[model samples]
Target: MTPLECVELQLAAYNERNLKLFLTAFAENVRCYRLPDMVLTIDGKAALGEFYAANRFVHEGLHAKLLNRMVVGNKVIDHELIHGLGPEPMETSVVFVIEDGLIAQVFFIPAKSPS
Candidate 1:
């Protein structure tokens, strides 16, 4: 699958809260990092699945609304507004790096509150 296709598939799975289908877009050794500092947050597909299943998919109202998307080569950058994690919606930017038809790495940019 192409990079954008893989990303879109994952987004669909995420919104559906389907852990099995969500994992299909990722590589076995996928790594997830928090950007700015590039701190590693999730390592490997198993951990990714576990984290989302236990921490995320359980939220019945959980959904990420895509605000914008930009594809550059093998990277897909998405601007999203996420709901159900808290009382208020959260916005974040996620960068997905695809390799071998699967997502290999992801970097998340947390939203900054306006001063």
Candidate 2:
């Protein structure tokens, strides 16, 4: 699949809460971090699977809307409206770096509140 297609498949798997399908879009040694700080929050497909297994179905009404998308080289950046991680929907941006047609790294950056 193309990089954008890879990200789309993962997002579909996520909404479906299908852990196995979700894992298919990622590399074995995938890394995920928060933007700005870039602190590694998840490492490897196994760890990511565990995280989703525990949290993916935590709440109902879980869905995401891609507000915008941009693809450059092997990277796919998405601005999204995410719901069900909490009580309210959040506007966030995620960057997916694809390598060999699998997501190698993901950076999730939630919109910051005004200071």
Candidate 3:
């Protein structure tokens, strides 16, 4: 799938709380980072799957709306409005690195103070 297609599929999987589809969009040894710091948040597909199980679908209304998206070569940068993952909706940015049709790395930035 194209990078955009992969991101779209991942978004669907997140809203549906479908672990399998979520995993399919990523490479086996994917890495996730928190931006501004680039701190490692998740490493490996199995670990990421566990993370989704614990956090992705805590509420029935969990969903994301794409505010903006841009593709630069193999990277897909998405600015989104996220709901239900927390007490209030949040605006977050996600950068996806596509490698061989699967996401190999991700950088996540939350709209909160990084302290």
Candidate 4:
């Protein structure tokens, strides 16, 4: 699959809350970095499952809409707005590195817009 297709699949899995599909889109050893602190280096399917379970609560009913996407080779940067999880919607920028058709790493940075 093309890099763009891989990204699209990942987003679809996330939106549907299909954990198995979501995990399938990731590499065995995936590195996830949440800007400003959180970092998780997960290995194997079991570890990925654990990570998903731990974050499942935070993702309950959360929907993310991609505003823009820029792809350079295997790396994609997405700008999105997320809804349904908090008082005010949150905007975020995410960088995804796809390797061999699977997501190898992801970096998320939160943003605040002036009201």
TM-score of each: 0.97, 0.93, 0.94, 0.81
lDDT of 2: 0.91
- State the lDDT of candidate 1 residue by residue for 1-115, as single tens digits: 9999999999999999999999999999999999788899999999999999999999999999999999999999999999999999999999999999999999999898334
Clashing pairs in 2: none
Candidate lDDT scores, in order, read: 0.97, 0.91, 0.90, 0.80
Report the C-alpha lDDT of model 4 over 9-108, residue by residue, as the tens digit.
Answer: 9888777778888788888877877775666656565777786667643577777799999999999899998776687778999888898998888888
Clashing residue pairs in all predictions, respectively, total 0, 0, 0, 0
Query: Between candidates 2 and 4, which one is better according to lDDT?
Result: 2
Badly placed stretches (over 4 Å) of model 1 are 113-115
Order candidates by TM-score, high to low: 1, 3, 2, 4
Top-lDDT structure, candidate number: 1
Candidate 3 overall lDDT versus native: 0.90
List, residue by residue over 1-115, the lDDT tens digit for candidate 3: 8999999899889878788888999999999999898799999999999888887766788889889999998899999999987798889999999999999999999888556
Candidate 2 matches the true fold with a TM-score of: 0.93
